[model samples]
Target chain A: MAEQSITSKPQSLKSSYWKAISAIVWKDLVAELRSRESISAMLVFSLLVILIFNFALELDIGTRRTVTAGVLWSTFAFAGTLGLNRSMAVEKERDCLDGLLLSPVDRSAIYFGKAISNLTFMLIMEVIVLPIYSVLYNINLFNPGLLLVILLGSIGYTAVGTLLASMAVQTRTRDLMLPILLFPVVLPILIAAVKASSGFLSGANINDIFPWLRLLIAYDVIFIALAFMVFDYVVEE
Target chain B: MKTKPRTLIALDILALILLGVSSYLALVFAPTEATMGQVQRIFYFHVATAWVGMLGFIAAGISGIIFLVTRNLKWDRVEVASVEISLVFFFITIVLGSIWARPIWNTWWTWDPRLTTATITELIYIAYFMLRQGIEDPDRRARFGAIYTLIGSVSVPITFMSIRLYRTIHPVVIGTQSAEAQGGFNMTSDMRFAFFFALISFTIIFVDLFWNRIRLGALADKVELLKLKVMQ
Candidate 1:
C-alpha cells in the first residue's frame, strides 16, 4: 500500500467522515445483495402482514384507497423494525460492531452508515410492496409526492431506529426491545407519512397533503439531528 | 449525609396540613358542580397530581441531562427520584382522571388526547426504569438512562401532537367528545381556592417525597458499594 501522508486539516477529516459513512453503507448493501438475508425476511414478513390485513380488513377496491396508506405504512413499520433489529443484531452477534467502533473514523460516520443501510432496506421493502399492493388492488401507487414522503418518513424512522436499535441490542432482551423503544418515538413520522401518502393516492386536495408533508419534513429534520447528536452516547463503550 | 434536615421535616408537616386543608376545601368547601355533582371534585386532585407528574417529568429530563454532562451519581439519584415520584403521581392522575371521566364522559376511559398522552408518558417513564433495570453496571445504567430520558423528552411532545392530530382528523364516530367535551364548568371561587391550594400542597408533598427518595437512592448506593467492597 502507498504511504499516504497524514493530513491535519479539519475539512479533510470531515470529508473522510462522510466517505467512511458511504463506505459502510456500500458494504452493507453489497453484503445484503450477496446474502439476501435481511431484506428477504423483511419482505416475507411484510407480505404475511399484508395478507393478514387482507383477511382482517377485507380491503376491496373501494375500501383499499382509504386504508392503503395505513396498511402499507404499518407493514413497513413492522418490517422495518424487523430489519433494523436484525441488522444491528447481526453486527453484534458477529462482533462486527466492536471492530467497526475501533476503526479510525468518527462515530457519527458509523451511525449514519448503519442508518443509511437500514433506510435502504426499508425503502426497498416499500418499493417492492407498493407494486404488489397496486396490482392486487388495481391502484397505482407510483406518485412522486408519495415517493418523496416515503423517503422522508423512512429517513426519519431509520434515523431513530438505528440509534435505538444500537442501544436495544446491548440489552439482555436485545431484539424484543427495539419495537417497544422505537414505536412511541417514531410515531409522528408514521402518522404524517400515512396521512400524506393516503391523500396523494386518493387524489385528495393538495392542501390536505401539505400539512402532512411539512410534518414529515419537520420530524425528519428533528429526529435525524437528534439521533446524530446523541448517537455518540448511545454507541459509546 | 446530613441527618434528615430540619427543613424537610417542616415541609413534611406543612405538606400534611396542606393536604388536609386542601381535601377539606375540595370535598366540603367547593360548591357541588351542577352537571356531574360530587364526582367532579376529583378534578381538584386530578389536576394537582397531573401538575406534579409534569414537574417530575421535567425534573427527570433535567437530571438525566445533568448526569450525562457531569457523570455524577448525585444527578442519577435525582433522576431516579423524579421518575419514582412521577410514576406515583401520574398513576394517581390516571386513576383520578378515570374516576372523573366515568360520570362526566359516561365512560370509564376515553382515548382523549390528554388521557392518551398521560398514559404514553407514563409508559415511557416505565420503560426508562426497565432499561435501567436491565443494566447492572451503575455507570452504564446511568449513561443509558440519561440517553433514554433525553429521547423521551423530545418524543413525548411529538407523540402528543400526532395523537391529537389523528383525533381531529378522524374522531370516534360513537363515543361522545372526551371528558373535556362534556362542557366542564368553570371553577367557582371556592373551587379555585381549593384547586390552587391543592396544587401548592402537592408541590410541597412532591418535594418531600422526592427528597426522601433521593436519600433512599443514596442509601441503596452505599449498600451496593459496601456489598461490593465486602465481596472483594
Candidate 2:
C-alpha cells in the first residue's frame, strides 16, 4: 500500500487496481492452459465420481431424471477441490504468489483476480460435464435457467474455495485440509445449486425455482465480498 | 506456577450447584408433558446447551474481528476459548437434540434445517481447531484462526437459512403451533420458570467455562514463552 503513489488520480487508481487483478488472472489462466494439469485431473476425477455414482445407485431411466442434477453438482463440487488445490499449489510451488505480494497493487485485487480465474476454470469444466452428463443420462441439461444456476453456484463455490485453498495450501496438511475446510463452508452453495437445478429439470414453475436461485445469488455476492475483505489477512506474511 | 483464581474456583462450585438445581427444575419441577413423557426432560438441557453454543459462537466471531483490528494476542486467546467452549456445548446440543428427536421423528437424524446447520457449524469449529493445530508460530496461528473464525461464523447463519428455506419441524416452542405435533408444548407457569431459569443458569455456566478456558490459554502461552527463553 505504501508503494501506491498517494498523489495518483482516482481514475488511475481504479484502473491500476483492475490492471493488477487482470495481470494475476492472466498469469494463472495462461499457466493453466499451457500445462493443462489442473483441468485434466479435475475432469477425470469428476468423471470417476459420476461413474461410481452410476454403479452405486443403479439408476434406471425413471430414477435418473430426478437424480441427474444432484449427481452433476456433486461431481462439480468434488472436481472443484482439485482445481483450487492445484491452482494454489502452483502459485506456492514457484513462489509466484510471494512475487505478487511484493507488488504495489491492492491485495484484494489479487484475491478477485484469482477468484475469477478459478470461477472460469470451474465453469469450463461444468460446460464439458453438462453435455457429457446429458448424453450419458439421456436428459437435456442445456436449459437457460440451469445455466444461470450453474454460473451463480460456481461463483460462490470458487470464491470461498479459492480463499480456503490459499490457507490450506500453506498448511502442513495441504492436500487433506482443503476439502475438510471447504466442504462445510461450501455446503450452502451445493444445497441451493442442487435444489435450483433440480427444480428446473423437474419443470417446476418459475416461482418454485426462484427462491433457490435467490439463495445462490445471495451466496455469491456475500462470499465474494467476504473473501475480498479477508484475503489480505490470509496472505499476509 | 500461577495459581488458579480463587474466584474461578468459587464460580466453578456455584456453577455445579446451579447445574444441579437446573436439572432438578428440568426433571422434577416441570411436569413431564403428556405426549413425549420423560423424553421431554431432555429439552431443558437441549435448548440451554444450544443457547450457550450460540453465545460462544458470537463471542468467538467478535473476538476474531477485534484481534484482527487491534492485533492483540489477548483477543486471540479470547477467540480460542470461545470457540472451544462453543464446540463442547454445540456437541451436547446436537446429541441432546438427536436423542429427543429419535422417538418423535422415528429416526436419529433428519435433514431438518436446524439439525443440519448445527452439524455444519460444529464441523466448521472442528476445522477451526485443525487449522490452528497445523501452525507452529502463535502469531500466524492467531491470524489464521481469526480469519477462519470470521468466515465460519458468517457462513453458519447463511447455512442455517439455506437449509431452513425448506419446511421445518423443529419444535416452535415460543411460537404458534397446533397442539398436535409430537414435541410441541405449551409452557405452563411452572414450565416457564424452569425454561427461563435454565437459560439464565446456562449463561452463568458459559461465562464460567469461558473464563477457565481463557486462563488455560494464557497459561499455555506463558509456558511457551518460558520454554523459548530457556532455549535462548
Candidate 3:
C-alpha cells in the first residue's frame, strides 16, 4: 500500500485467483502463528464454553452421548464468530484489506483467502476441543464419520461466518453484530452439524444420516458460491 | 408529488374492503367447529399473516439479488420495505398462533419447525436493520444489507428442513402418536372458502402495503438528500 497510486494494469483472472488466495491464506496463517491472537483466543474461549456447559448440564452416563454433539457444535459456533470478528477487525485495523483491494489480484482471492484462514482457525479449535470433550464425557468421538461431519459443518459455518464477519467489522457495533448477524444465517449449518454428529455418535445407520450430510454440503456450496460471486460488491471502494 | 395517484387511493380502499369481507367470512360466514369451536376463527388471520410473511421473505431475497447486480438503491428500498413488512406480519402470526395454540394444544408454544423457523426468520429481519443502522455509508450499507439478506434466505429453508427432520425422528408427540398431536382439523366447505379467501386477500394486501412502503421510502430518500445538501 506504500504505492497507493492507482495502477491501470489489469490482473489476469486465472492466476490472480489462485495466487492471491494462497498468499492471503498463507499470510493469515503465518500472522496467526506468530501473534497467536485469534487462534488462542478462539481456542481458550471454546474450552471455556465447554467448561461452562459441563457444569451447566447434568449429562449422566445415559444422556451424555446424546448431548455431546450439541455441546461441541455450539462451542464451535461461538468460537467461530470470535475468530471471524477478530480476523476481519485485524484486516481493517492494519489497512491490510485496503492494501489487498488496491492490488491487481481479483477481489475473490481475498474472500477465499480470508475464509480458508478463518476455517482453519475454527477447525484447529475443534481439533483441540473434541478430544477434551471425549475424555471428559468418556464418549468416543474418534469415529471417522463424526470427523467428516465436523469438517463439513465447519466449512459451512466459516463460509458464511467470514462473509458476515467482514460486514459486521465495518459496522459501528463491530463484534456484537457478528453473532447477531451470523447465528441466524449459520443456523442451518449448526442444526445439520449437530444432527449429523448425533447420528454418528449414536451409531445411527448411514442411510439415516445421509440427509443431514447432504444439507451440510448443500449449504456449504451455496454460501461459498454466493460469497465468491458477491465478494467484489462487498469489498468495492 | 403534489397529488395522490387514483390507483393508490383505489388500492387502499380495495385492501380495506377485502380485509372487512375476509374477516366477515372468517368470523360469520363459516360455521362453528366440532372440537375447537369459536377459537378456530383465529386460523383465518393466522394463516393469512403467515402467508404474507413468507411473501415478504421471498421478496426481500429477490430484491437483494437484484440490488447486488444493479447496485441500485431502488432495489435496496424494496428489500428493506419487504423485510420490515414481513417482520410485522410475522409478529402478528406468532401472537395469533400462540393464542390459537393455548386452547387447542393446551400450551402457549411448541418447538414446532414452522414456529421455530418463523421466530428465527424474524430475528434475522431485526438483525438486518441493526446491521444497516450501524453503517454510515449508504452504498456500503446497501451492499452489506443485500449480502446478509441473501445469506439469511439461503439458510432459513435449511433450518426448517433440519428442524422438521429432528421432529419426525424424535416425535415430541407426548404419550400419544395421534395425528391430532398438534391439533389437526378437517376444514369444511365453508371453512375452506374462508381459508382460501384469506390467502388471496392477504396477497393483495401485501402488494398494497409494499407499494405504499416504497413511496414512503422515496420520500425518506428525498429528505435525506435535502438534509445532505443543507449540511454541505
What 10-residue stretch in candidate 1 chain A is worst by lDDT? A1-10
Model 3 chain A weakest lDDT span, ten residues long: A1-10
For residues A1-237, write the lDDT of model 1, one tens digit per residue. Answer: 111322434556667887788778887998899999999999999999999999999899788869999999999999998999988988897799999999999899999999999998998988999899888888888899889988999999998899989988888778877888888777778878988888888889998789788888888888889888878887788
For candidate 2, what is the DockQ?
A: 0.77
- List per-prediction Cα lDDT, in the order shown: 0.84, 0.89, 0.87
Per-residue lDDT of candidate 1, residues B1-232 (tens digit)? 4588788889889888989999999899999988778998888898899889999999999998898889898999999899888988999999987887766676788776677778888888877877777777788888888888888888888777776765432122134544334535667778888888998999988988898889889988988888999999
lDDT at A211, model 3: 94
Q: Report the C-alpha lDDT of model 3 over B4-119, residue by residue, as the tens digit.
A: 67898899999999999999999999989888899989988998999999999999999999998898999999999999999999999999989988888788888888889999
Estimate TM-scores for all models: 0.92, 0.95, 0.93
Best by TM-score: 2
Angstrom error at residue B28, model 3: 1.6
Using DockQ, give the best candidate's number.
3
Indicate which candidate wins on lDDT: 2
Q: Lowest lDDT 10-mer window, candidate 1 chain B?
A: B167-176
